[model samples]
Target: MTTDPKSDGGVTQSPNRPFGLPRWVIGVVPILLLGLVVGGFVATTPLAGVDGGEPLPDVSIDYTTLPNDDTIRLHVTNNAPEPVTISQVHVDDANWQFEMTGAGGDRTLEPLESATIEIPYSWMEEYDYSVTVIADNGATFSTTIVAANSSPGLTGQVVWTLTVIGFLIGIVPIALGIMWFPFMQTMSKKWLNAMLAFSAGVLGYLIFDGGFEAFETAQSVPSGYSGPLLVVLGISGAWLLLQAVMDWLTDDEGESRLSLAYSAALGIGLHNLAEGLAIGAAFATGRTSLGMFLIIGFMIHNVTEGPVIIAPLADGNRPSLVHFVAFGLLAGAPAILGGWIGVSTQSPLLNTLFLAIGVGALLQVVFDIGDIVRRTGSIRSAPNMMGFAIGLVFMYATGLFTL
Candidate 1:
């Protein structure tokens, strides 16, 4: 009977494979895994560091006593393998005196050696300043002083202002997205393609030109980095994080794209906050030119980000003003945070690293949204391409590329 059945191929049929996995199961896992990996990389990888660590030479400044009457004692140590030289000491008041016992201007010492610098000053109010240190190997480190009795009032006010400004600016994206929705929907595929191409151009230019330049400028300001190796790693890590996040929020094959949209928005928000901090901090620390540049560049980028936020909502067949505002807030709050952080810390390495992360994250975002936009309508439309070109023009006009 078995032979007959086999030979006859009676109704050749295979046993059912336990419902492999719902479509969601297939799509969700890979996407989730990818996203998680990307997030991990973004969080952990030091793209702006030396050998994946903080780039500046390691040096410690110890204060022996608080400023009371006569003088405040402090000690500076070179902890890294390289020789560190004290380039400049900036104190607030003239009453404060800086005395370098050893070779002051360009003193060179091997790692683990200590130098005692006495700052004899009598001041009732607490103070802060930047001390620039140059390594024998030409690595520079700039550390900002934070007093134990630092005034939180001034700092708190600055933080509050930044938060308000960020919140306000965030609304623009939501508005722009809504206003342009009708226009984008009517565009032809060719136009759409043009738009995407334009978007790609802007992002590409920013990453290769603006992003790289920012990193170099950062390296120049305070001696940092072992070279391009760290920069490449940083870029890779950022991409990995972006991929991980996208995968995490994406559903199974052919599933809804809402989760990914949400995740991207969240990432964008976090990114903006970091940017805001950069602007605020630079202004706070007397880097107005740099701060202004970042603000203008980001503002343009944020405008484009608005459309990305709403695309998901549209896909779900639901769009509302309330949700728009909420997304705006989520996206915009970062400016304030970025501003505050930038102002608070005087670490050039930290600032530059954060900037690189922003660049990386933004690149991921452009790619993710571009994918969505293309699928919605054909990318072969004229208007759509024009829109994208307009966006790119903004970037270029702002000198984001030249920087």
Candidate 2:
């Protein structure tokens, strides 16, 4: 009996599409285009509120600084849907004359626009001061400066200092942790499984810690950006994107142990990046004690991550020295980059987004480690359970130093 090439047992099959694209793309493209068109129409049309009520005013004090003994600088953003005109500035309940720069010199801020306002006033050091900004619509926004101090600026010497701190906090301890690979090689199968579970436990704690930080950071973002929604989107987007990438990388048998190790390292690296940002921000804001404590705390907390990255390869074919170095850098190097960014720029939106992404990625890594443990032995086994508990407790104990 002769059968058509495109038919299976008398059932017709759909022919391959052009360019080997997935069938779902055929439906998705049109819907996406339609959405874009509708969005464009709505954005271009200036429709008043449905109730015809007056537009509300929203302005955010992004940053404040004391440039000198007699100068107070403020970075302000107009988050309102309508334009806002800055009419007056008040310091400690007294009206003060100020100069405006950026976003048109007319002291008018268009929607979502930002400007810098400089007030010439003698501010006392170590004294609390409150500044209030008034717009033409009778709306007021205020911010307080506690123990006022000059903001730090980036210079050659400052850059070098931050780099050294990043290296010590982010790289040195992780390298020390990687030194345990040789000893881990001699462990039995049960012990190896326990170690893997321990790694998962450490990561689980990080997910909780990072998620909490993300939420707190979100509170600082401008209301126009919907900070809470941004966190949700960042977390969900990162989790789904990483999952898709992992799915693409897996073969018919599933993900290899080496790939899982690399994923763990990547997740840990992102977490370290957020840690570095915190350290940089603290130092930049003159919180020297806070920065010192963060450095000490992170040094202790990150050491455990090195072992976690190499745990999957403990029983497999031995990796070369280069591979070991690569793994360490992958798990620890982003702290340096994060420190530079946090110190150089003060953007709550960016900080919140990065923190959310780190939390999401680490959460995915925890699940991957759990799968690895399940494949080796029963997850509920005494050794694995005990190891998990110990790991969690160890991280919590080390984390206290930061607080």
Candidate 3:
């Protein structure tokens, strides 16, 4: 037996330690830190301040552009202690040029009741204005209303056909993931490890951007914490929902790589649905140029998604063709479904829901990729970090030029 120069007789000297924490402490500390991060974000977020209790004469007004006209639908919800009567609604502009009278001269809204009324204004440019809502009891407030980006009108057969075609094209990128079905053997373990990290990076960006958009969308409506609350629920709830299903499906056989792939597919599918909504909405609003552009850009962006879902599968032996198709549908079908709904109507609540769900699911996939890399002791490797950064940059650049 030979002792190195650092060793004194038979006793070996310890390597220089930085934090001086034990190996187990170092390993366990990250989990503790993660918990703290989640806790802090929840505690500090505005969602914690959401009040759902009864109110006295409090009201909320949410607005969205109606299809096929220069009409804006104002959804008014009353949060008062008693029945309230609304006398008038006028755009608080200098000219006071736009107004909406109470429906059939019936404007009384019972406590916790809602009313939807339309305001018509023909302006090709984005109309930004404050609508002054008045109740007979003298409670009044002005809500900001912005016009829809796309011009929605007359979606006959031609527009409908184009919308359907655009939606189908959006799903094409998701299906492209099937190409990973072959030659898993060609990629070595190191290569697989790098790809998994790369997958994590791409998912990370989506989650960040998606979550932000969901929160911002709700905030725009000034709808208390409902938006952020819904987003948080979407993320955590979807995670729990998928986990329960995955356990039920694979508990007997234990989790397989295909199951993980399925999870990734499911998350990406929800996200892609949002993309489809964007395309459908553009065309539904009569913006053919923007709709086609979004489809093209999203299609290009989606090319990377297949590999994201399939990267984890590379850890296992070659997966069957059935597995690939199943994964594709699990992730890709939502886009088609979302397009149909988006074309008919645009709902902010639903938009936040899907985006949040995607954020949640995608986060889970990222965590899963991290677990794989950790288990293989490649998480901190240079190749792993390089792959992750490259993936993040590549996805971002694709998004920059396309989305």
> Global lDDT for candidate 3?
0.70
lDDT of 3 by residue, 253-342 (tens): 225456778889889888878866665665555555655665566677777788888787665566677877777777777777776667
Q: Where does candidate 3 stray beyond 4 Å? A: 1-56, 66-72, 79-84, 92-105, 120-130, 141-169, 221-225, 251-255, 281-288, 291-293
**lDDT score, candidate 1, position 299:** 57
Specify the highest-lDDT model's number. Answer: 2
The digit string of per-residue lDDT tens for model 2 on 1-403 reads 7887877667766765423456788768889999999999799875644578768889999877776778898889898899999999999999999999987879999988988999999988788999999998789999998898765666677677778877877787788888999899999989999998898888888888888888898888888899999989988888888877887886533336677778888888888888778766765555545466677787897789888888888887688798788887887888887778877766778888888888788777777778778877899999999998888999999998777
| Decoy 2 TM-score against native | 0.85
Per-model clash counts, in order, read 40, 0, 2
| Per-model root-mean-square deviation over C-alphas | 12.7, 5.3, 12.2
- List TM-score per model, in order: 0.56, 0.85, 0.73
Candidate structures ordered by TM-score, highest first: 2, 3, 1
Lowest-lDDT window of 10 residues in candidate 1? 12-21
- Model 3 TM-score, 2 decimals: 0.73
| lDDT digits (tens) for residues 1-403 of candidate 1 | 4553323235543233113445667667889999999999899976747565533577665223333444544445566666666644445422233666644444554466656666655534346544444454556544555542322223567677666556544545545654665665565555545555555555555455537654674653322243344555555678678778668755653333555445445556655655565566555533345444454455555576666554543434455566556676666666666767755644445555655665676577667656766676655566666756676676567655324
lDDT of each: 0.55, 0.82, 0.70
Residue pairs with colliding backbones in model 3 are: 57-80, 151-285
